[model samples]
Target chain A: MRATIIHKPGDIRIEDVPEPKILRPTDAIIRTAATCVCGSDLWDYRGINPVDEPHPMGHEYVGVVEEVGGEVTSVKPGQFVVGSFATSDNTCPNCRNGYQSSCVHREFMSTCQAEYIRVPTADGTLVATPDQPADDLIPSLLTLSDVMGTGWYAAVAAEVQPGSTVVVVGDGAVGLSGVIAAKELGAERVIAMSRHASRQKLATEFGATDIVTERGDEGIARVKELTGGIGADSVLECVGTQESMLQALRSTRPGGNVGFVGVPHGVAIDGQELFFSHVGLRGGPAPVRRFLPDLIDRVLDGRIDPGKVFDLTLPLDEVAEGYRAMDERRAIKALLRP
Target chain B: MRATIIHKPGDIRIEDVPEPKILRPTDAIIRTAATCVCGSDLWDYRGINPVDEPHPMGHEYVGVVEEVGGEVTSVKPGQFVVGSFATSDNTCPNCRNGYQSSCVHREFMSTCQAEYIRVPTADGTLVATPDQPADDLIPSLLTLSDVMGTGWYAAVAAEVQPGSTVVVVGDGAVGLSGVIAAKELGAERVIAMSRHASRQKLATEFGATDIVTERGDEGIARVKELTGGIGADSVLECVGTQESMLQALRSTRPGGNVGFVGVPHGVAIDGQELFFSHVGLRGGPAPVRRFLPDLIDRVLDGRIDPGKVFDLTLPLDEVAEGYRAMDERRAIKALLRP
Candidate 1:
């Protein structure tokens, strides 16, 4: 099986790796239908996150179940399925609380950018489509595994509701997906902060009522100006940086919320600053498994077209080019066909 | 008029100060019916928060209206009222969002311990009682100005819902009030963390179902044990220190919330730590003004008696003794009568 592996910074390769087999009674082996390069992957490709040792890459996938352990009952062979980046035993306390990403028996999907991937806690992590999804729905369904699910979690965490004024920080695939989520959740006005003409265009098409191309202080000022000088009711922080986090916090009204979904690298929030801001904050790995059922329905229903984020696509053997394109900002996201 | 002044750390004195005059059309003068020393006041008395120079102390008071400014019409002279420590115009965007403490036109009541205090934004800040309460209700009504209202805000911020398992992480007056708040909010189990037996007794009387006397890691373990090893649904953080904040965070389950109100002095939260914990955090100076009407009704209806937190009482002139007693931990709180 061909798998995406990072040897070091700036070194991504497709290597011949052994096919994954069901290692646990609850595991299921899936032949990946589609996978993609994530903005988060740039962390290692750019050497922002240390590459201590060579490791498999990618955590997003839509696939067909090839094999299943005896204990796996919810999904079976030949079924088209979508699973979250994080695997979970849905019966755990955290999973029951709708935070499957924090499940006690959780394992992040790290080897999914391969021909075949082994999914643990299959019954809880994998959600089968009503039937085999059409090829056109594959990309949208694939996003439900992580990015789209994450965007929905961001909107929900920010408490977006009908008549809410929402601001989305960042213009990555997840941020663009957040624009759709905000609109789906009935946000009256969705503001997308992006400087990229292409990403801003996509954000607008995906339901952003306004776009602010500024960064830092100017960005905060712009959001405040649009929100009657107080700030939006909810701000979605899709980029995890000190500046982006601060911008999200400052761009929200005192009683509003900031739902941060980006994986924080070196961010440290000052306690007094947060206290005075009076903004509610909740961020972490998205509980994608919790939203899989509904999101899949939305995808199948054609209510949202998240697949548009994949502006570039390539054969799995060209995985290195995919990584390079995203790392260099040449592609919003690159879908890989196995 | 006489007022309590902090000359420096450990130097609290009663001094003759000029009487307050209407400085704005929105101001109203009040003859202090009762004022109390707060735990936050100890911040300056102990010098943790620097006392740059001699300054009037005290922000909690229930008083009788002495005179109103030209534009003040909500209350007239001779009416007894309870006002929040943080004054708000109650009409700004932040105030309309129920974050009155963050109002555009806001002022902290620093001269409340004096014989007479001037309250700014009287119409938006002061809530007149149905009638002059009996002598016994004075203490509880006075607490509505800050402590009780703060506790209610903590519970509200923590999202205490019916059947929620709550943890109150401070033994101060505000924390004790939080216990009451949690119960009132319909939490099935209320856990109060306090090592002092006197405070523990008060917590129980205020409706705490259990008490955890431990602190730090051990305290987290105890709370987890009580909550089936996943931690509480909501944790009210009333003591704002790095240790207390971390303990509160660790003691809440994933997807839980921490409502912090202790006015953090030197706390910095690592983004990665909070991200992994998956706990929602919202803190600030409590919007006491938002919860005033409801909390006052609770006091009047005899559903709550937050005044019990003031175990020590003294004449207004003995303000120094009141400060000393609280600073030395000889009293949970002290009430001053002018």
Candidate 2:
């Protein structure tokens, strides 16, 4: 099987790897139909996150089950399924409470970029559709595994209400998707911060009532201006940088919420500022599995077409090029068909 | 008029000061019947927070209205009243939404230690008793002005559930009162972190089910051990420090909440750790004015006696000793009868 592997910074390659097999009683082997390069992958590719060894590259995917272990009851052979970036035994107390990402026994699904991937905790991790999804639904459904679910979690954590003025702080696929989530959750106004023309268009299409082309303080100023100088009622911080975090904090009203979905990279929050502002901060690695079922339904019903985020697509053999495209900002997200 | 002034670190003086008079159309001069030294006041007295000048102190009080400004309507002369540390015009949008501490026109009652103090925003800041209370109710009514209301806000922000386990991260007067609030809010178990024997005793009396003598990581471990390694459902952090913040985060379940009421000093939060923990953090300078009325009712009905926190008493002229008792840890809190 061909899989994407990173040997080091700037050294992404698609190489022949051994085929995956069910190694656990709760495992399911899926023949990957689609996978994609994630925004986080660029971190390793750009040398921001050092790759100590050749490691599996992607975590988001939609696939058809080729085989299932005896303990896997929810998904079976020939079924189309979507799984979260983190695998969890949904029976755990944490998972039962919808914090599956923090499940006591959790596994990362980074090997999904390969032609065949083994998914553990299959019964609790994988959600099967009523039937095989159409080819057009594949990309959208693939997004439910990570990006869309994460965006939804950000919105939920931010407590976006019907009249909430929401500000999304990142313009990546997840941030763009948050615009949709905030709107879907009934936010009265959605503001997307993006300087990219292509990303701005999608943000507008996804229900962003306003778009702030500025970054940092200027972006916060625009948000405050849009909110009548009171700042946003809810802010979804999708970029985990010091500047982004500070902007999110500065742009939120006192007693408002900042729901962060971005994987923080050395960002530190001043407790005094958080305390004095009275802003409620809640978020971590998103429990994407909690929202997978709902997101899949939305995708199937055509309520959202998150697949549009994949501005470039290629065969699994071109995974290196896909990584390069996203790494260089030439593409918003890249889809790889296996 | 007599007032308590912090002349230097660990030095307090009870000295003569000008009697306060109505300074604005919205101000009222209150002849304080009772005032108390707070845990936060010691921050400056201990030099943890520097006091560059010999400033008048104390922010918690219950009093008789001695004089009223032309525009003061809700509270009139000779009326008994309990008001929050923060004086707010409750007509603002923030106040209407139950966040009076963040009200557009908010004022901190800085010199409540004085015999007569001018309270700004008097009409909306002070909540009068339905009738003049008997002498015995003064102690409990004084508690409603700050400590009790702050505790209730912490419990509310933490979202204590009917059968949840609650951990209070500080055992000061406010934290002990939080135990009362948690019980009132229906928490099944309350754990208080305290090393002082007197504070521990008071905590148990206030409804603490357990007491952890350790701080930070060890304290969190004790809480986890008590909760079957799952952590508490709600944690109230009444001491704002990096250690207390981390303890609050580490002691809460993945989906649990940490309600912090401590004024943050030099605390800084690691974004990645907070992101991965999945705990909800919310709190600020408490919206005490929002809870004062209901708490006053609870106090008046004899349902809760938070005045037990005040272990030491002094006349207004001896307020310097009140500050000394609290600063030296000889008293958890002290009351000054003016």
Candidate 3:
């Protein structure tokens, strides 16, 4: 089967890989329907994260189960399902507490960006709909596996309450979707930081009440200005850079929260600053499993179309192009159909 | 009037100073009934935080209102009152949100070490009882002004839930009082890390269900072991060292909270680790104004006695002894009578 692999910085390739099969009692083999190049994928692609060797490329996917292990009861063969970026046993204490990303028995699903992928702990990791999803819903459903769930988690972690003034500090799919999440969660105002005109348009369409074109200090200043110098009630940090983290921290009002979904890189928080600000910090890898069910429901009800983030698409054989498009910032996200 | 002053590391002196008087329209002059040396005070005494020049020593106090400025309203002359370590204009947005320590118009009350201290923003900073408290309640009421309020803020910031497991990462008066706050807030289990036998006894008396004499890594491991391989649901960090902060982070379960009330020295948090752990971090200087009224009620009702933390007492002229006792670790906390 063909899969996306990174040989080194700026060198992603589509190559033949062994087909996946049920490896554990709770495993399920999925025939990939759609997968995408994620914002996080750019971290390794740009070599910011060392690519030690050729590694699997993506973690988001929507697919039909080709086979299921004897212990897999929740999902069966031929059933279409969406899985979280991090697979979990779901019964673990962490998963039970709705933090599946930190589940004791967890597995990254990056291998899912291929013709076939094996999902472990299938019964607890995969969420199947009542029936096969219609063909047209594939793109939107694919988003539920990661980007959508991640966005929702960011909003929830930020504690976006009714009448909240929310600031989203990334222009990628997750940040754009965060705007949607904040709106769905009842935020009175959503401010999206995006220099890209296209993303800004989508942000406004998705419910961003304001868009700040500046970055870093200027961005924070704009947010504070929009909030009457009090800063936003909640800040969603989607870009894991030090500047983004600091902006997120400074953009929140004293006693407000900064929910960071960005994978931090070279970001070190000064304890004194955090202490003096009294801003609550909480986030992490999104507990996508916890939000998958709700996100799928929203998709099915036509309440959100997160698939709009995918501005480009390609065949599995051209997966490298998908990575290139996102790496070069030509597209917000790229979809790969297998 | 006499006051305690830190001239240099290991050099504390009792010197005559001008008596305080109302300096602002919102100020109130209080004759100190009791003022105690705090853990933070030891920072300057030990020279971890430099004492550039002789500076007034204490920030915690309970006293009798000697005089009130023309604009003072909530507290008046001849009334028993407890004021926080930091005085805040309680009408600000931050204060309205219960983060009085970060109020737009906040004032530090470190000069309280003197025989007479002037409290700024008196109407918003001091909480008075219905009548003069009996002598027996003075010490406990004094505790409410800082240590107890700080402990309560730690517990509240950590979001201690009913029946949750709580771990307190310091054994100072604030940490010991945190055990009381945790129990009062309905924590099912409270673990206190204490090396001293006296502090251990006080912690246990304050409803600490477990005591671990270990520090840092081993201490966190012990807490995890005690929680059945999972960490505590809430951790109160009352010690501001890097090790204590990291230990507090590592001792909390994923999705749990770490409320820090310590005045940070040089603590730095690795964002990646904090991001991956999914633990919530919230804290800072205690918004004592928010907790003062409730704590006063508890002290007045005899429901709690925090005065036990004060093991040594001295006249204002002998304030140097109080500083030495606390600095030498001979007393958990010391009280000064003026």
Candidate 4:
């Protein structure tokens, strides 16, 4: 089976690797139907996150369950399924509290770019569609495995209400998806912060009522200008840099919330600054498993179409080009089919 | 009139200061009936928060309205009233959103240690009691101006819900007051992290179901053990140090919240650590004005006796001793009668 491997920074290869098998009683093996590149993957590819040795890549996927260990009763072989980047046992206190990404027996799914992958804690991590989804629906369904669900969590974490004014602080696929999530959650006004014309168009299609191309202080000022001089009711931080984080925090009104989904890198929030801001902050790896069921329904019902985020598609053999295109800012996201 | 002044760190004095007069049409003059030394005051007293020059001290007080400016109609002269240390117009966007402390027209009361003090935004900052209370209720009522209200904000910001398991990481008056708040908010188990015997006793009286004496890692571990190894639902961070902040964050379960109220002196939060912890963080100068009315009612109803935190009392003329007693930790808090 072919798998995506990163030998070092700026080095990605499609190498033939042994197919994954059910390694635990709670695991299930799935034949990959679709997988994609993520912004976080660039952390390693760009040498920002050191790569000590070559390793399997990818954590998002939608596939057909090829086999399941005895203990996995909720999902069975031959079922078309979607699973989160982080696997969970679901019954743990954290999982029960809607933080499945923090489940006590959690295992983050890697090597999903391979032809076949094993999903641990299958019962809790994988949600099967009602039936085999149409080929056109696969891209949207595949997103439920990570990005779309993550976007939904961002909205929920920010406590976006029916009358909320939301600001999305990223232009990547996740940010565009967040626009959809905010609108679905009944946000009356969704502002997408993007200078890229292509991403801006997609964000508008996904329900962004406005766009602020400014960055830093000017960006904060622009948001405040649009929000009656205070700021938005909620801000979804999809980019994890210090600048993006500050943008999200400062663009929210006093008593508002910043749901930061971007994994922070080198960001140190000043305690005194945050205290005086009076803005609530909650961020982490999105508990995608917790939102899979609801998001799947929304996708199936055609209430949302997040697949538009995938502008470039290629065969699994072209995984390297996919990474390059995304890293060089030529593509919002690249979808690879095995 | 006599007022408490801090000439420098460790140098507190009772000085003859001119009586306060309404400086704003929204101001009202109050004859101080009771005031107290707060834990935050010690920051200035200990040189942690620099006392640049001789300045008035005290922000907590219960008093009788001496006079009202032309625009101050909600409070009348001679009426007993309670006003938060952070005054608010209550009509601003932030105030309307229940973050009165961040109101557009906000002021911090700093002269309340004097015999007579002026309160700005009187209509919104001062809440009049239905009737004058007995002298015995003075201490508790005085706390509503700051400590008690701050504690309530901690609980509220921490999202202390019915049946929650709460951990309070401070034993000062505000933290002791937090124990009461957690109980009143329907927490099933309230853990007070305190090593002081006297404070532990007061915490127990205020409804702490358990006490953890450990600090740092041991404290986090003990709290985890008490909370079924997952951590508490809500952690109130009342002592604003880096250690206390980390303790509060580590002791809360994923999806739980940490509401920090102590004015942070030198604290910086690592974004990565906090992100992976999955704990929501919201802190600031307590929006005391938001919780003033309810806290006043709780004190007046005798349902909560936060006044018990005042283990020592002094006349306004001996205000230096009041500061010294609290600074030495010889008293939980000091109530000053003018």
Candidate 5:
């Protein structure tokens, strides 16, 4: 099975790895149909997050279940399934409370940029599609596993609702997906923060009513100006940087909310500023699984097509090029076919 | 008129000051019946918050309207009233959305330690009781102006739902009041983290179901152990220290909420910890005015007595002693009568 691995920062390879086998009673083996590079992967690829040894990459995936352990009941062989980046025993108290990402028995599923993978807590982690998705629908279905579901969580955490005016910070795949999520969640006005023409075009098509190319104070000013100097009702932070976080917080009105989905890096927030701003901040590793059922339905019904975020695609053997495309910003996201 | 003044750290004196006059069309002069030394006041007295010049200090007050400018309508002369430490024009979008403390035209009402103090935004910041309260309720009504309202905001921010298990991270007047607020909000269990016996006693009296004398990690562990190793449904961060904030964040169950009202001092939170915690954090200068009407009703109707927090009382001339008592921990709060 060909899989993506990083030997070091800027060093990528595709090698034949052993096929996955069920290791837990709740495990399920899936033959990967599609997977993609993620923003977080850049953390390791850029050496910001040290890769001490050669390691497999990728966490998002949509696949066909090849086998399941005896304890796995919800999903079975031949089922087309989507699962979040993290695996969880859905019966845990945390899972029951819609925080499956933080489930007490959770196991983070990584290294699925491969031909096959083993998913633990299969019964609780995998959601089967009503039917096998058409080839055209696979890319969209793939996003439900992470990026799309994450965007939906961002909107939900930000409390986006009907008639809401929302601002999305970042123009990555997740940010673009958030535009769609906000629209699907009934936000009346979705503002996308972007400077790239391609990303802006996709953002507009995904339901962004406005775009602000400025960064930092200027970006915030642009948002406030557009919002009549009051700021947005809700702000989605899809990029986890100090500047992005502060911009998101400052972009929300005093009584509004900011939902951040980016994996924060070097972010330290002043409590006093947050307090005085009176903006409610809620985000983390999104409880992506919580919104899987609803989002999967939306994708299946053609109410949304978040797959448009993938601007490039390649075979599993070209995983290195896929990573390169996204790393160099040549592609919004690169989908890999196994 | 006499007022409390701090020229420097530990330098307190009762000074003869000019009588306050209505300074704004929306302002009113109030003959303060009760004022108290707040924990924040000690910040200036202790030299943490420098007092470069001799300045009168007091914000919390329950009094009778002595005079009103032309624009003052909701509150009139001779009306008994309780106003929050921060005065706000409640018509602002923030106020209309229930965040009066963050109102666009908000003003901090200082120097109420004197016999008469001018309150801005009188029509919005001040909430009159249903009727003049008897002597017994004065202390509780005074708290409505600050500490009590702040505690209630913490509980509300933590989203204290019916049957929630709540943990309060401070045992000061605000925290003790939070216990009462949590109970009032229908929490099944209220845990107060306090080292002092006296403060713990007050917390228990205020409806604390449990008390943990531990601090830092041990305290969080105790809270987790009490909740079967998962953590509480809500945690009120009543102290604005980094340790208290982290403890509060760690003590809440994933998907749980934390409402903090501590005037944060040197607090910087790690974005990754907050993100991974999957807990909601909200705090700051509380929207005290938003809760004033209901709080006043609660106090006047004799449903709750938050005023018991005041353990020492002094006349305006002995204001120095009031500061000393609280500074030395000899009193939970010191009430001043002018």
Candidate 6:
């Protein structure tokens, strides 16, 4: 089978890889129906996060089960399923507590941008669609694997409610998805931090009531201005940087909640500042598998169109191009069809 | 009036000080009935947190209103009152959000260990007791100014509820208070991490179901072992050191909450580790004023005895001994009568 591998920074190639086989009794082998290049992937592609060696790429995918180990029961051959980038045994204490990403038996499912991928803990990690999704719905369903669930987690973590004033930091796919999540969760107002024309349009279309083109202190100032100088009740942080993290923290009112989904890089928070701020901080990997069922229902019910984030789609063999397009800001996200 | 002043580390002197008088329309002069040395106060006494010059000591107090400015309304002369260490207007956005400790118009009320002390924002900062009580209730009421309220804030911030297994990292007055607060809030099992036999005794008396004397990694191991390897549901961080903070974070299960009320010192948390931990962190200065009403009711009703933390009491002139007793760890806490 062919898969995407990064030899080093800015160097991605499609090469032949061993066909996936169920190695464990709880494993399932699936044929990739849809996959995508994630915003986080750019960390390695842009040389920010070290790509140690030639490693397989992609963690997001929606697929049909091609085969399953004898012990697998919940999912079977020919079933279309959506699974998160991280696999987990849902019965663990952490998983039961709704933090599947931190599951005791958790495993990162990489090399998913391939013809076939083996997923461990299949019964616990995969959520099957009610019916075979149409081709048009695959891209949207693919998002359920990561970005959509991640964005939803951010909103939920931030305690977004029916009348919450929300501020979403970042205008990428996840940030835009958070706007949708905030609206679905019934936020009264959502301000998206972005200066990009296209993402700003998508943010508004997805439920952002306002868009601020400022960064850093200016961005915080704008959010405070919109919130009557009190700051937002909930702020979603989607970019993992010191500036974005501080912006999210400062953009919230004392006793407010900051749901930070960004994978922090070089982010050092001052304990004194956080102490005085009184804002609650909570976020990490989205337990997407825990939320997959509800999110899939919403998608199937036509309440949200998260697939709109995929502005470009290419053949699996051209996965490198997908990365390139997103890296150069030519597309919000790139979908790969196998 | 006589007050306790810290001329340098280990040099606490009883000195004549000017009588406090109402300084603003919102101010009130209180005749100090009880004031206590706090764990934070020891920071300066130990010279870790510098005492630059001769400065009056003490921040926790419970007293009777001696006089009020023309505009003071909520509290008045001859009223027994319990107030937070910090004064707030109770009308700012932060105050309205239940974070009065960080109110925009905030003022730290120091020099409280004296015959008379001035309280700013009297109407919002002080809560009167139901009735004038005997000296027996004075100590407990005094804790509402800081320690007890701080412990309660830790529990509330950590989202402690019925059946929660709580871990308290510090065994100081605040940590001891947290045990009481956790029990009052209905935690099923309260764990106190303490090495001191006396402190451990108080912890169990205050509702700690278990005590683990280990620190750092070993302490985290004990907590996980007690919780079926899942970690505690909620952890209260009352010690602001880096080790305690990290221990509190590592001792909780993913998705669990860590409510920290310690004044942070040398606590630099790695963002990546915290992000991966998936534990929620919240807390700062306890919004004591917000919880004063309920805490006062509980103390008056004999439901809790937070004042037991004060193991020694001295007349106003012997205030220096109170500080020295606490500094020497000869007393868990020391109360001063004026």
Best by lDDT: 1
Query: Which wins on DockQ, candidate 4 or candidate 6?
Result: 4
How much lDDT does candidate 6 score? 0.92
lDDT of 3 by residue, A82-160 (tens): 9988999999899988999999999888887799988989988899987888887888899888888888889999999
RMSD to true structure for each model, in Å: 0.8, 1.2, 1.2, 0.8, 1.0, 1.2
* lDDT per model vs. reference: 0.94, 0.89, 0.90, 0.93, 0.91, 0.92
Clashing pairs in 4: none
The lDDT-based order of candidates, best leading, equals: 1, 4, 6, 5, 3, 2
Clashes of each: 0, 1, 0, 0, 0, 0
lDDT of each residue in B1-338, candidate 3, tens digit only: 88887889888788888888777888999998888888888888889987788888889998889999999888888998899999899998889888899888887888878888899999999998899899888988999888999999999999998999999999999998899999999999999998999999999999999999998789988998999787989999999989999999999999999999999999999999999999999989999999988898898888899888988887877777787788778999888888
What lDDT is reached at residue B41 by model 4? 90
Q: Indicate the residue-level lDDT of B263 in model 5.
A: 85
Interface RMSD of each: 0.5, 0.9, 0.6, 0.6, 0.8, 1.0
Q: Write down the lDDT that model 3 would get.
A: 0.90
For B1-338, candidate 4 gives per-residue lDDT tens digits of 99999999999999998999889798899999999999999999999987778899989988999999999888899899998999899999999999999999888888888899989889999999999999898888888888989999999999999999999999999999999999999999999999999999999999999999999999999998898899999999999999999999999999999999988878999999988999999999888888878888888889989899999988999888888898889999999998
Give the DockQ (2 decimals) of all models.
0.93, 0.84, 0.88, 0.93, 0.83, 0.79
| TM-score per model over all chains | 0.99, 0.98, 0.98, 0.99, 0.99, 0.98
Looking only at chain A, give the TM-score of model 2 against the true structure: 0.99
Identify the runs in model 1 with alpha carbons over 4 angstroms from their true place: none
In model 3, state the lDDT of residue A53.
85
Query: Which candidate achieves the best DockQ against the true structure?
Result: 1
Clash pairs (backbone) in predicted model 5: none
Chain A TM-score, prediction 3: 0.98
TM-score of chain B of 5: 0.99
User: How would you encode candidate 2's per-residue C-alpha lDDT over A13-116 as one tens digit per residue?
Assistant: 88998998889889999999899999988889999998899988899988999999988888889999999999999988889878999888888888988899
True-contact fraction in model 2 equals 0.83
